[model samples]
Target: MTRTLGIMTEGNDVEALYRRLAWRRQIVLLTGLAALAFSLVLDVATGPAMLPVPAVARSILGLAQDRTVDAIVWSIRLPIAFLALAVGAALGLSGGIMQTILNNPLASSYTLGVSAGAGFGAALVIVLGVAIPLPEAWAIPAMAFLFSGIACAGVYGIGSLRGSSPEMLVLGGIALLFLFQALLALLQFVASPEALQQIVFWLFGSLQKATWPKLWIISAVLAVSLPLLLLDAWRLTALKLGDERARGLGVDVARLRIRSFAIISALTGVAVAFVGTIGFVGLVAPHIARMLVGEDQRGLLPASALFGALLLSLSSIASKTLLPGAVVPIGIVTSLIGVPFFVWLVIRSRRAFW
Candidate 1:
């Protein structure tokens, strides 16, 4: 009778602990959503041609009394804000997925060379005058998308040759990074001064390039890919138990990796193609989310996405406000902001999140 009472008490304790964790996760998610909302408003309202918060809201709701204000709000700031949110969410989601599958906290789109490949493809179009049948604006991003896919395929193929070991995939990514960097340098070496300037600026990752069409493209991709990821959340969680253990549970480790790689490449490619290479969001956001919510992918994934959108939206606001009348490249801003946080994250935690 005493043993039965003790068992009941222990089970209650376990249930209480789980309830506490669930409450904490909910709080984190809600906080992230609130931050994202605030950042979006600040980004749209605090630009060079600043608009009042109420005015911005009115314009967005189609009740603006001024045409110019409406145009600025609708045509420029709104799209840029939305793009930042979408791009950040995509990067965060991809980062979370990559870290889980690769069993590497440091794994991200930029580290895996997807950004370098996209950069090379954009450079080819911008510097070497490579043309496709697509419209002028679509050409560069299309090539970037294509090259990013090619790079992921190359990395996967090389890794597969060695049984698709995580270390092999990391090594293959590093190799591709250097190879693409070399190719970009060669293109820059031969580029005309004007073309060189364009190439360099594109690499700087600006949201000034945001358009409704590009935002739609990114949104469509995220809409498709995010659901697939959420559905695979359990499998990804299984992978955290180590590849051999996961495979023993019928996870099909190799197939999961391949599918995830393709999805991540697509997400990363679309993001880099439109916005240039915004680094560190993917690398840092997941860690932040993991630290906040533990390793449960169901919560971690959405929390990561929310944190990412919040970070980039804040970055967008900073880029505009840092200078009195001029905006800086967002990539520079993100690195400056994210690197310090990343260092602190490493220092603050001694426990492995996995």
Candidate 2:
């Protein structure tokens, strides 16, 4: 007699996976919409003017036409909301991609030092008086994107040389992060007190400086980059297995890594440029998305983007409304929630990141 151990993909597993994806997509879309509506409401209702929810809604819809409400909604809140969603989405998706590529759960815009690079760049502008001469509006993110790109490039190049390893990538990122932090410190040391204050504020992060133009720039970056990342979702998902494994399955590991690095760099760079170093959303949102959607890139990537948008939008609203009189910076709010979540994620997934 011969006995065989049988392997099967349970019908329940297949149905459960599909059902979960459908449910998650619907939930993500609905919650994302709800978060948007709530963001609009908070935009009109939470400012110094404090308009009623219905009136604020009407003004947004262009039905009321009250100048003050319209101005507040259009000139102020709308831009802020849009920036939060767009940056949040970019960070979220970047974090997801980083984790997938590195196979590390703690990977995020902040944790991996991408934000530190951007912060250092912004700090340079603040200290050197270079960015100051430019339109005050374009300064921060300009420096941010530039530095983030360079820093990411540095990390990737060092990590992907012949016979390079993931360990080198993580180590290099950490080292570069400290290097940038040192640069920020040196800039702060030579700066005047007032200039130093500006640098400090940017380092901590804020949305108080947000405007419609800046929002447009950030939104444009996301619009251009997100589709490209999504288009490569299949190759990205394949990266979860080892590069050698992916190659055996006919994936071009080198090309995939280069493409992913560029996309992640741009995503994180744009976000840090616009908003400073808002932490936790990218790391947390993608993990949440993975938990909900399994490992499929098609579902996982969009889910991270949607959830990220909702997370940041909600955080922005909370920072504004929670204090009742003082408008909290979006970064502060995110860090408060993010730091703890990150700590927990790392502790839980010690094998991955540690």
Cα TM-score per model: 0.95, 0.88
Error of 1 at 337 (Å): 0.8
Q: Could you tell me which residue pairs clash in candidate 2?
A: none
State each model's CA lDDT, in order. 0.89, 0.78
Q: Name the candidate that leads on lDDT.
A: 1
Instruction: After superposing candidate 1 on the true structure, give the runs of residues whose Cα lies further than 4 Å from its correct spot.
Output: 1-7, 62-67, 351-354
Q: List the residue pairs that clash in candidate 1.
A: none
Residue 187, candidate 2: C-alpha displacement in angstroms:
1.1
Task: Return the TM-score for candidate 1, rounded to 2 decimals.
Answer: 0.95
Which digits, one per residue and each the tens of the lDDT, describe model 1 over residues 1-354?
Answer: 999999999999999999999999999998888878777877889888889988887887789998988889888899999999999998888888888888888888888888899999999998766869987578999999999999999889888889998888888888998999999999999999998998899998999989999999999999999888888888889899988988988898998999999998899899999999889999999998999898888898998888888889988998998989999999999999999988888888854244
**Per-residue lDDT over 1-354 for candidate 2, one digit per residue giving the tens place of the 0 to 100 score:** 122222234666778888978887778667766866677577547766577888878877789767877877878777777778888888888888888877778677688778999998888777775735466557767878888888888878778664446677777778788888888889999999998998888877777767877777777877887788778777777778777878888888777777878888888887888778888889888876776666778878887887788788888877877787888877889888877876776677643352
Worst 10 residues of 2 by lDDT: 1-10
